[model samples]
Target: MISFKKQLLLSMIYTFILVLLFQSTALSCTTLIVTPGATIDGSMLVAHSDDNHLIDQRIIYVPAMDHQEGELRPVYCSAAAIDEFPQYASFFYPRINATDRGPGYNTPGFPQSIPLGYIPQVAHTYAYFDGSYGIMNENQLMFGECTDGAKVQLDPKPEKLIFYSSELSRVALERCKTAREAVELMGKLIDEYGYYGTGETLPVADPKEAWVMEMAPSPDETGGLWVAKKVPDGEIFVAANQFRIREIDPDDPDILFSSNLFEIAEKHGWWKAADGHLDWLKTVSLGEYNHPYYSLRRVWRLFSMVAPSREFSPWVEDGFTRDYPFSIQPDQKLSVRDVMMLMRDHYEGTEFDLTKGIAAGPFGNPSRCYGPNDGQGDVGNPNRELLGAWERPISVFYCGYSTICQGKADLPDPIGGILWVGLDKPSETLFIPFFAGVQSLPLSFSQVDTAQFSRDSAWWAFNFVSNWANLNYKAMRADIALMQDKYELKMLELLPVVQKTALEIYQSNPDLAREYLTNYSTQNAEFLVKEWWNFADQLIVRYDDGMFSEPKKMAQQVGYPQEWLDLTDWSQGPITYKKRN
Candidate 1:
């Protein structure tokens, strides 16, 4: 066995190598959970921003299957690494194969996804909608994932452990029907087998409840350590690539954890239970990555927005500040639209508004994707190693895609759950509802090759619009919102009528109900993707050369905003031709 010193040294060496090859998995991802009672319709919601580097943006469908008693479920390395290793995966994914690569490898890519281990298979596995992570199963079990960096960064080696958060969530979705079942199952698996990859927070939700489960790699041979706390039915929970579960209390029914959780931490000197109950974040985590406020600022913003009466301050002493509560009751009950608004934010009205700064450019586009390493290092800052960091907003320009798992308790699983998928940056996307009943998605949704641009992929259409909007964001934003409202509001009204029809069909035959629901979902996606492509073309003509034009009029040259013009560095010489020539 390696000594403790050797483990720490090996982890650091592995981490340094990862940053040089693959960008840090700690980049950015915001995930949240809204409990049933906190939502206006009394439905649980789990939302995630798949904000990683070069991710496979396609959404794949996996149908339920029966298994033999003696069958063992094969587990591979992380599926999250699909962002880079396309060869390790088939674009035609999860459905066709049993041992398809798990997005579980959140560390560096394996040369090939050879299985780390296997577990006993259940008699029946439910169908699920999967992106990089398993979204929702036929039972309405859902997951929202965020990768958080920890002090112990174990390399996902062959013999030690294999499952990353994506794979763990996928397995949970296939096997469990409720949030409690998932948390318990995941904890049991981690105890018996092992977990690999970086620190991860998964908001697992079902029609009845939602829970925040946080996991980190164990430094010893035990595999992994995990802790989960159920968000109260009357409150909401948010995690932005950091552990939110605190105070390991075994007696608390709301909290669930592994037996060796504290023992592992104590052995590593991360925490000592003798002092008090273990503080999970302070003990097990590296706090935040990239910058100090990188995680907290987003977390604070969500709390402030949901319950403005609390007036949560944007400022905190550091990332570990106790200023923000783990969960909170909102000022008003939220709807699915309200939750989407939470996901699509750039801190617009607040002091930290990304669109208001000089860096936002002349058009007020809030995309600040450039990293500290992009330019010369920030020589002035004390933490010279970091160089600098950007304020990561909820809706980021680099986001591959996002999902809101909307789960309703009043209806059956098929009708109760909708995996609302947005292809690009949340700010630039129109969320399309894909019901749990769908056995297949529109083929266009699964046909993305990020290495090359293609008209065949639905993701590219939104990608095109998002990238193009930067040219004249101010003019184009309003134009985009018009369409957003047109479809979204219409869909909002259309959903109830469709639900009524599906329910009527369900009474006679479940198969027919699924068929009807599937047609409505796939057809809407097909129509929306085509319309969005047309919108992108219209945006090209309307905003060409920084001019604004519509169907009946000639192009109008709308100059830069006065605020932008004033902020511009004319000192570099917007030189007068009379003087210079």
Candidate 2:
């Protein structure tokens, strides 16, 4: 039997250990949205380093329309379309849409065909050109997550192939003089040959601004294939796993984009003749069953936060299902900040949030689930819990056009129009501008793999800082915020200085530029390590129950909430330094 004081200490230790264990077991990745718009040229390409260390990059793209029969090729395309095509597209284009085997068939039988020697397979792959990888092009702009309406297939054409590269629109724009001609040509190509990825709805700043097209594969198609619609001007759209461009307005060139919506529907007799506003997309394709529940919640969350006037709550379910306004015209033009926030949003302050109180609220912690409190839960149906770690990673990868422009040949160097792909984990990753014009990177950035705990890599720095903060969320969140503020300011201060110095070196000596960027990377890594250590030290010293006694201050350091203040008694039981045997 333990003494009363010892028992109290043991209880506190046990609770702390349990919570810490929960935290360790609960962590998972978050979703992020990349918004790099399309470019006519294939110069700038950027993607998040999937390895998390930012060493190995993930390149994604839509295969060229004409090259469907050739060897396997990859291209960057839209986000929502990709999700829809693989995870949800099949739900729409069922073979039952055709003759004989109709709706009652249960499973939609779609066909798969590949031209040339290219055998189709699905699983994420690196988007690349020639051989080398890492953002080496200036024209590679990848914008994703254009929330559109639902898609369905009244008549399934399993043999029809599709393209998914976002650049198809831009390619059309470059070939055509006006937007109308561009849309027409794009439609023709898509109608003749299907696409394989999400179409990019490009709005570029240039001699020609075009909207790229994209589409999803029919249920019958092999592993991976997507199609895109011919983009029309003056008719803006939104997308979130649902098809956006539905009907083909052949006469109204200003209000359509697709290979041939009317032609295809007519050929298959999928569209209704009598209609006030015929949603051909719904007629030919499929709409989200739980539009509000699964699809629009993301958009509603964004619009609610950025443009309150257009706000729609996920919890506010009404009688009318599809009656809610579908498309929203932003009161203001989209900006980088808007894109960034959308990518980082976690349904905070909403009903859908998976992390509010461990039950099924929306705080959506990426690491752990709420039910059972224990780490392990049902494996097959992880979604039963409030927060599903495996289900949703915290930050989704973001690929968007930066205001900067650079040429392709110069991308091998980080300074040249190098791609700006990055992990969208807020306060954890920095979007350091890599210009096509710059010559090199700081040493701190490149030389990081060697660092250990004492020696910190940029990857390790963020992991340590974020994990340390999570140790006592009630206390450490503030410290984490404080750390972010200081770190960002420091980065802002250092980047320009580093940029200017590196530019000067590049002009004087190009070789020096490479060395400079590499060094800068290292220096940036070092700065992060130094700051993180200080923050971690504060956590260790303050929470150790030796140098400090005030549980409130400890809470402050770890970022605990006010409600947890009562829990302070747990920390005050007694400081035990005994190591677990």
Candidate 3:
């Protein structure tokens, strides 16, 4: 009774599901999804789960500041900012100096300044944004590049510009009465300090509105001397490992941020005059030829998804190269979903995808490397290899491993607004909402230690479901979808109860909110585990049926490709124009 088309669809779906299950356990790739709303749990918290031993722990990195008195001083600072009100404190591990008697290696007089700031003192002064695991700041203000070297640690520069340190950024909490004030303050600080950051985008985020500031290095400094400009409002932008700011909007302050972007390029002779105007993009990319691999590919991938009409190739070597642009503001207003999808995406459709069935071997996987043990799997191309071990392909662990809190005193009673969307393999993972207001995380959530197999952690939970689904794809896919549907409905059903309970506690006893959220998380984790196991078992049985004989199974496909349905489509669609060979 089953149609061939239906059977084919089911088969494909099964294959895709199996891939998810296999990959989930094979490595550590997780996506951190966040959503915001006003709640009693306070403002500005980073909440998520992770596989590393450093999970749920606060991180702080401080740098030495040279005082006008010619003395180097140490300052304590938060890894990130928690609340944008009353006080500015972060849940960062204060940097400690470690010293050893052995001459091999001794901790320096100071701990590492979480080492990614345009202004050094700002690392301690203002909470330099920490994206928990991968990205420190969500509004696209980030530092630290993914290179195959020991983690980088920057020290003080000879010419101290402004006290425009990251600590000075804390001034936003002190001086800026409003968001507009904060923007103006940032601009002034950049003007004074020279905006020295080694990130793709600039740091621009408050609790309400966020902006991306992209910078380009000056030609004289071997890509060292730099200036940054802010991204415009109403448009969503993201920068991953490469510069993203593009175009000069002289008319709109909300749409751009360039520190003498035009004047400096022309004044310094870095940019050639074009029709009496300096060509910014051309000048930036003159010496830098690896733009696609270094940066633009991510932009093309993201923009291609939200607006598929644009034509850009992730693999092809176009005239474009590095120093391409600092920002690329699209012509449309980006929605929350668009931003979320962009953040969670990988190089799936592009030639860079290690898993791309087509042209994968030919083009090579940018996400891979030559491993010490070649037996682990395929080794990446030598020309462009990614650093592996301790690094994730997409680094989703940060999304689930850290807790978002504003300040220790202002911690939300029941921080319930945690959102974790397992983009690459979300179906296998259950995004349990945890609140900073809670007293303790479940023992299982905290049980992560070595990278070995264990079901007591969030990583393992994903591993469990994904591993089983991998063995049998089609049946697992349907089962996983069904479970997700039920889980979503249950969440919808429970949200009201949770909200009402939170309100009641807020009125009667404020501290009780944490208890409610804590209990809710523990119970939710247990119940979801049960659901995952049950659904996984159901697939085990159905997948054993292998052959497509059942009519009920055949009817599930609704004329769509099973593989395409579950993807977090960052691209709009297939290009309408045929390739001209």
Candidate 4:
């Protein structure tokens, strides 16, 4: 047994670890929503990044099921689902004990039979794609979530709080078909069953329209308070772990909310009649969760890039600043590819650009290694954690996976809805299409054990290439870009044919269409993933020991940039001998 003093020290360390782990998945995500009118092809799009260290990079298919009249839908302890997906264990010890990445790292898998509780079930549930959160469903209803900061963060309690944003999203996909239907159902469930976990903003979209719904737990933790506003057609919305919905009309049809939204605010002294309508951020959110500019910079950069003419100042007070609009209309209509390009941003060419500083080193790498004292005030110390926060860019290197959900009104659901998935970092990943109608996903997407590296994992394939490029990013990136474009462009070129063939087959036999899509999707994923491993190997051989090598051509030495070398303090190093002139 441990001594009391030692136990106390261990307790403190455990608490600190818990906070870090929560912030990793909860506060680091970024979201994007594009309405049909804003896109070139009139496709509603929702994109999300599961930006966390050691997050579950896999994507699975949750099949449609029909239940008995009295059958209840199990509400999973999503916070405790690490064993089922095997990702929760990767975050440390907060999840399924069997797969705990701790001392029990190699423990056998255990079934997730017990749930936090159960909710009223629907007779018929829809088939959908599942990732870190429930993704798109068979009906083209899709969602993307960003967990933000709030006044109260609660763990899922047995009877009081049973739902998290992840479960809410999965349930919505399991039952709903329209954007309005999903928002209304989630708000009702939160009010009746209660909600837990950090504040969240989910970008919900269908072929017809797109909307963002924001939710936060009530001060008393009695239930959840919420509000949602539809993204006006012709506009694009971005959610970066902060509440962007402001004053609620309460009367507008587009704005939906929990009944107690105003009452809870007033009761908690977060709102007043004389103070005017309720402000979601002022009343519920704790401003920016992490550090200043962590969330806002991402929002500002995305908006400014799409609508360059309507520029917004990058400098904002915090996540609550009104400088950035809730959504903006792009000057030009965007394509699916254009949206993909936008998500790969690093705040380049702006003052806040992550690649230009001395901190980026000689290779101009934009990836910032996260330190513990990032959000907390940095005390001047030799410890690296106290060195202050880095600029959190839209394209994060730590991202487990990122997705773009495209729901088209013109085509059938099978051919129309596509989940464009990219493993690892958005900057380096080649987006692969996964059709909503596919019966199964490629085994590589969900078969990995994150505790160790496996060549069979598609995530590892992209992850290997990305982590390798960090060493000589400025040089090796050219080859990475070539590999990415070679396959990605090829896929884009074949998309028309695949859709046309799939649609024709879908008209006659829906099952065959699904099989065809599954084969195509699986083949593309497997083929590219295989090639990617070779790509990684080539990068090592070509850039070996900081030299650029090629067939026939002699190996050429690569050195540091003149600008980086000039910035160095020569006197800090041993004296260098120079030829006397």
TM-score of each: 0.90, 0.51, 0.49, 0.90
lDDT of 2 at 123: 32
* lDDT of each residue in 257-325, candidate 1, tens digit only: 888888888888888767798898888776765467777898999999999999889888876788889
Q: What TM-score quantifies how close candidate 1 is to the native fold? A: 0.90
Query: How does model 2 fare in lDDT?
Result: 0.36
- Give the poorly placed runs of model 4, Cα more than 4 Å off: 1-26, 80-108, 111-113, 377-387, 569-581
Off by over 4 Å in 3: 1-197, 202-208, 215-234, 248-251, 255-298, 308-418, 421-428, 434-447, 450-453, 463-485, 492-497, 500-581
CA lDDT for candidate 3 = 0.37
Q: How does each model score on lDDT?
A: 0.78, 0.36, 0.37, 0.78
Model 3 poorest ten-residue lDDT run: 144-153
In TM-score terms, candidate 4 sits at 0.90
Off by over 4 Å in 2: 1-137, 140-142, 145-193, 196-214, 219-239, 244-248, 252-256, 266-270, 275-285, 289-292, 311-342, 349-355, 358-424, 436-469, 489-581
* Positional deviation of residue 402's Cα in model 1 after best superposition, in angstroms: 0.6
Report the error of model 2 at residue 180, Å: 10
Tens digits of per-residue lDDT for model 4, 378-423? 1111132434678889889878889999999988998899999989
